[model samples]
Target: MEREILLLGNPQLYEISEDVKKEELEDLRPVFEDMFDCIKGIRRDYGFGRAIAAPQIGIKKRLICILTDKPYVIINPTLEFIGDEMMELMDDCMSFPKLLVRVHRYRHCILRYTDENWEKQEMRMDDDMSELIQHEYDHLDGILATMRAIDNKSFVMKKYANPSLSK
Candidate 1:
């Protein structure tokens, strides 16, 4: 299934996701697979997308699949360590589809998640990769980088000023 990329300025982009169960993960796998294929198809056309969320694909679930290719499937994901030591990065989202915004993010993150095998694990992310993880995780919660910009009073450039930001 070639899932169309959800663009920025879409109201569905801000709809928070629901928690997922172990069984739901099984049901969502095909969707996730299609999303991966879609993202892969877009990769060369688009640029870097280390991660993407279910909401970004127009499904509101607490689900995200990250391709560290070590890959991770996080259900009911959340962010912590939102403190001063964090880095303020300029980021864009596949869900937002476009619009780059300078937003604050943790320099490092300890993510506790359930892998594809239904095993529970915790992993850490730092630097640009950390930013990528946080960006996608926010999508799981239906929050876009632009919303972060609105909260942080950061500026969001109009679309395709950074074309790579598009889904």
Candidate 2:
């Protein structure tokens, strides 16, 4: 089932997500399925959405579905390392597609997460993947990119923020 991505005012988006237990991972197939469906739906509508956290769909679980060259699931993700280098970029979320927030994110990081089978895995990611994972991880911690905005001037409507980009 395709789940609705909770909007900015939705309380579920602000609630801290619970970590999924190893035993319960298998039972969460439906939630994972729905997350992937939600991401697909968002991309279809917005033309750009690489990942989505469980909380965005009101699941309140520490899970994120990412689509790159292929689809993958990350359960109970943790940032194992953050590089000293930082980069500023306009970040958008599925919850607020019309808004873009300028935020700073690590240029590189090491992330550890569990797969669908509960096996532990770690990967080193460069700026793009690191930023994407950080954004999704913040969602798991009840943190929105809007909250991480560099300043008052950092937030802007997507249309006004990037005129060159298609709506």
Find the candidate with the highest TM-score and give its number: 2
What does candidate 2's lDDT look like per residue over 98-134, in tens digits? Answer: 8999999999999899999888999998889999999
Q: List candidate 2 segments past 4 Å from native.
A: 160-167
Candidate 2 lDDT at 52 equals 94
Pairs of colliding residues, candidate 1: 8-96
Per-residue accuracy of model 1 over 1-167 as CA lDDT, tens digit each: 76887887788887878877787777888987877776665555555466778887788887777666666667676555535577887786665434578888888777777777778777676788778878888777667777777365576654443455555
For each candidate in turn, the TM-score is 0.82, 0.92
Worst 10 residues of 2 by lDDT: 158-167
Candidate lDDT values, in order: 0.72, 0.89
lDDT (Cα, 0-100) at 89 in candidate 2: 98
